[model samples]
Structure formats: C-alpha cells, structure tokens
Target: MPTYPAFRIHQDAQGHHAGIEQLPRPTPAAGEVLIRVGWSGVNYKDALAGTGRGKILRTFPLVGGADAAGVVEQSAHPCYQNGEAVVVTGWGLTHDHDGGFAGYLCCPAEWLVPIPDGLDPRRAGIFGTAGLTAALAVHRMLVNGQEPGLGPILVTGASGGVGAMAVAILARLGFSVSAVSGKPELTDWLRHLGAAEVLPREALAGATRPLEKARWGGAVDNVGGELLAQITRTIAPGGNIAAIGLVGGHELHTTVMPFILRGASLLGCNSVDIPYPLRRTLWNHLASDWQPPDLEALVSETVALEGLPPVFEDMLAGRTHGRVLVAL
Candidate 1:
C-alpha cells in the first residue's frame, strides 16, 4: 500500500498530541474525489486545534488543516473529473473529517468547490478560510444594507488573518476601513493593506455607555469580548457587525439597545458549514471584483507541513499576523 505524510492530531489516553505521520493513501469512494493537494493554509482554528488549547475536534486522530486547494487526481463524482482544480474549506474539515494537511485528500465531492477562474491552487490557498470568512461577513453585511456611505468599516483584531483580509476586501470595495489591532508595529502594514486608520485597541475605550457616540458605520469583529461589546455600543444606526472569532472571550455581555434601538445587526460569520450555494458565490466574488489589491502582502509566512508546529506556536502566541500558507 502506498503511504503519504499527514499532520495528524490525537487525544488518546496518553494525552493530546500531533505530528506528521505516514498513512495509507486513500482511494476515492463513490461520490468522492481524491485531490492531489498542492496548498493549504493555517487559520487561528488550526492553531487552537493543533495546540489542544481549544475544543475544536470532536474526534481525534484527524489530519489538521481547514483549507486546501489542488487538482483532482481521481474522481468518482459527476461534478468533477481528473485534473480539475478544486478548493475546499470549512465543511467537516479538521473536525470529524481528515483535513488538508496531507499530500492527498479523499473527500465527498460536495465539500469541494471548483477553483474559480483567476485563481490557481496557490492563490486560492492564500485566501483559505480567513479570506472566505471575511468575504462572507461582507456579503451578509451588504445584503443587510451595509454601504460605504454608512461610515467607516471598523475591523477589530485587524492584524489577524481574517481581520487583515476584511480590511483589504473592504478597501477594494471603496469603504474607508479603520483597523484596530493590539500590535503597534504592524500599523504601517495594516495601512498598506488599505486601512484608512490603524488604531490601537484602546482607541475603542470609553464606549461603555448604554449607547455611546456612533462612530463605525459597521464592523468586522474578531475579538469577541469587551471590544465587540464596545463596537455594539458605538456602531451607527443600521450598521451590521460581523462577529467572526472569540480569541479574546466567547461570552458577549451587551444590551438589546444596539439592536432594537439603533437597528444594529450582529451578523454571525460561520465560515465552517456555510451552505454550498453561498460558498460558491463568495468564492467567485473573491476571485473577481472583491479580490484584494495585494494578496501577497496579506501573507506573513509560508511553510511546509514540517514547519507547522512552530507556526502554530507563534500564531497562538500572537507573534505572527496575516495568513500562514501551508505548501504541501
């Protein structure tokens, strides 16, 4: 039997552990495809799961990556054929299912999206989960009436992967983006990614009133604790908040005044398990008009499977920013 290397994670009696291991290569079953994965990327969720710091995987001993783009090596599904390029993110990846941290991935065809025109495997991997989530947030906000004229779009946790992507995409769509990040040294980099202003985390200070002065027209919030609460209190009337992460804290303590009174909408961006139709739409937009001006600038690191542990450690420690591409 042929074998391939994979970054597999486990939580047996010995305790949580993960590392690359040789595993028997799988053949595609009916309604499935075997992809020769060319690229994958690390997200905050990957760091959490790899470090065992968060309860991300319900079942253990699975390959550990959330995003992948590659060419189909074999197909038992009608929608795809051998040599067709494909991309996969979210849908059962890195949870119960083995994910993209391997040389090959055999999965149900439904989970794969044909790599839209204008993007090859490497470029799609750069977008990965972070870019998709950012697109989804923007999509929801737009459907709910978000517009550049509303006010500046405040992207909290602006140095992180999703926040950085949101900043670039929003700027491309002509929104004045204000980025809030704890890393001062990355201020210039964030501005280059198209933020009109790079504010420190404390810039949102004193927004504790039941309703403070409305500043942001809308927001893409990655830090979900007090910062998100602060955004809720200050977003303009009818602004939408796309809540994406909880690295700061999961619990949201705020009043309904932001919703009922101001008509503020808190949109939850669950990149994982997003419906297939919407997923395809978002990918098309990402490849086309909504494409960022500089995808290379959003990437801070690129590493192979062997380098993932250190990258995960640095990412969890807040030593890195933007996207981390995993070249297979």
Candidate 2:
C-alpha cells in the first residue's frame, strides 16, 4: 500500500487536535470511487469541524475538508471512471465521513459531480461549497419569483464566502446588489464584485419592528440572529429571503407580519444532502452564466494541508475573507 499524506482531526482526553499524518492510500468500495485530490477549499463549517468549536463532526480521527476537486484514480461505480475530473461538497463530508484533506479520497460515486468544462481543479476549489450554496439560494429565489427588475437584492455578510459569491452572481444576472459588511476596508472590493451599494453591518442592528419600510426585493442572509430578524421584517411584498448560515447567532425573534402582511418567505438554504439531480443542474449553471466574474479576487490565499490549522483559526476569528483554497 502506498503511503499518502492526510490532515486528520482527533479528539482525546486533552481536547481536539488537527494535524497532518502519513496514511495508507484508500481504495474505492463497491459503490465508491477513489480520487487523487488536487485542490480543496476552506469553509466556515470546515473551520468549526477542525477547531472543535461547533459539533460538526459525527466522528473523530477523520480527514477534514468539506470541498474537494480532483481526478478519479479508481472506480467501482459505473457512472465514474479513471482520469475523470470531479468535485465533491457537503454530503456529510468532514462530518460522518473521511473527506478531502488527503492526497487521495474515496467517496460514494453519487456525491461526485463532474468538473464543468473550462473549469480546472483550482477554480472549482474556489467555488466549492460556498459557491454551490450561493447558486442554490439564487435558484430558489428565482423559482419563488424574484427577478432582476423586482428590486435590489441584499446580501448580508457580504465579504464572506457565500455572501461574496451571491453578490457577484446576482449582479451578473442583472440584479442590483446591496452588500452588508463590518469591514469598511472591503467596500471597494465588494463594489468591484458588483454590489451597487455597500452598507455597514450596523445597518441591520438595533431594535426590531413588526415591519419596517420595505427595502429589498429579496435577500441572501448568511448571518442569523438579529440580522435575519431585521431582514425578514424589511423585505418587499412577495419577496423571499434565503437563510444560509448562523454565524451571528441562531435565535430568531420575529412575528408573522412579514409572511402574512408582506407575503414574504424565508427559504432555508441547505446545500448539504441536496438531490443529485439538483446538484448537477446547479453546477452546470455555475460553470456557465452564473459563474463569478473574478474568481481569483475571491480567493484570499492558498495553503497546503499542513497550513490548514492556522487558517481555521483565522476564519473563526473573522480575520479571513473570501475563500481559502487548499493545495493538496
């Protein structure tokens, strides 16, 4: 058996720890495929899993990466074959199963999506889970009747991975975007990403009202808690809010006014465990018209497997922006 490098997370009497180790390369099982991982991406959930902050892991002593793009090296599944490029995100990766932080990964074939034409492994890693979630959120909003002329779309946590991607995609789709971020330094960057207006994080702060002046046609909120509550109350009639993350907090204090009076809807965006068919549809769209215009600008840094620990720390501290691609 060939020994390959992997980054593993372990929990012991002392506490949780993550580091690189040499392990035997894995082989595909009956319905799985083995891939030589070329690139992986860092996500907030991956940071939580690696740092033992959130209970994101169903099991310890496992490889820790939530998004991977690579080439298939072996396969026992009919849908995939050797030399084919594929990408994997969510589907309990870095949670219940070993994930992409290894030189090689063996995962169920159903979890794999072929890398779209014109997208390389490195570019796929830039999109990873964040881009996928953004695409799904936008898709749901459109299905619920959101359109470019409806009104401006508000994206909370605008400098974060999902928020940044949402801003870019919505702008590309011809919708005006209002981005909210605490970092004033990101104003120019957010604008460059196509945000027509950049608002301070405090713009969503303060007391909550049963209803506020209608502001947005739709919203993509990555921050929960009070911010989400504020967004819900401020949506225009018949608009939708795609709730994606809970980085701010989870408790939602609001009334039925938005739903009953304004006819607003809160669509929970869960990228994990999406039906394979929908996954394919979304990936195809992302590779085409919905793709970010400047992917390299969204990537703040790229690190190797051994450098992931510090990157996770920076992410948890809110010191990092955009995506962090991991080169295996």
- The Cα error of candidate 2 at residue 183, in Å, is 0.5
The lDDT for every candidate, in the order shown, is 0.94, 0.92
For residues 1-328, could you state the per-residue lDDT of candidate 1 as single tens digits? 9999899999999899999999998989899999999999999889999989989998988999999899999999898989999999998999999999999999999999999998899999999999999999999999999999999999999999999999999999999999999999998999999999999888898888889999999999999998899999999999999999888899988999999999999999999998999999999999999998788999898999999999999999999999999999
Quote the lDDT for 289 in model 2.
89
**Local distance difference test, candidate 2:** 0.92
Looking at candidate 1, what is the lDDT of residue 208? Answer: 85
* Candidate topping lDDT: 1
lDDT of each residue in 203-322, candidate 2, tens digit only = 766647899888899999999988899999899999999999898799999999999998999999999988999999999988898987887889988999978989999999999998
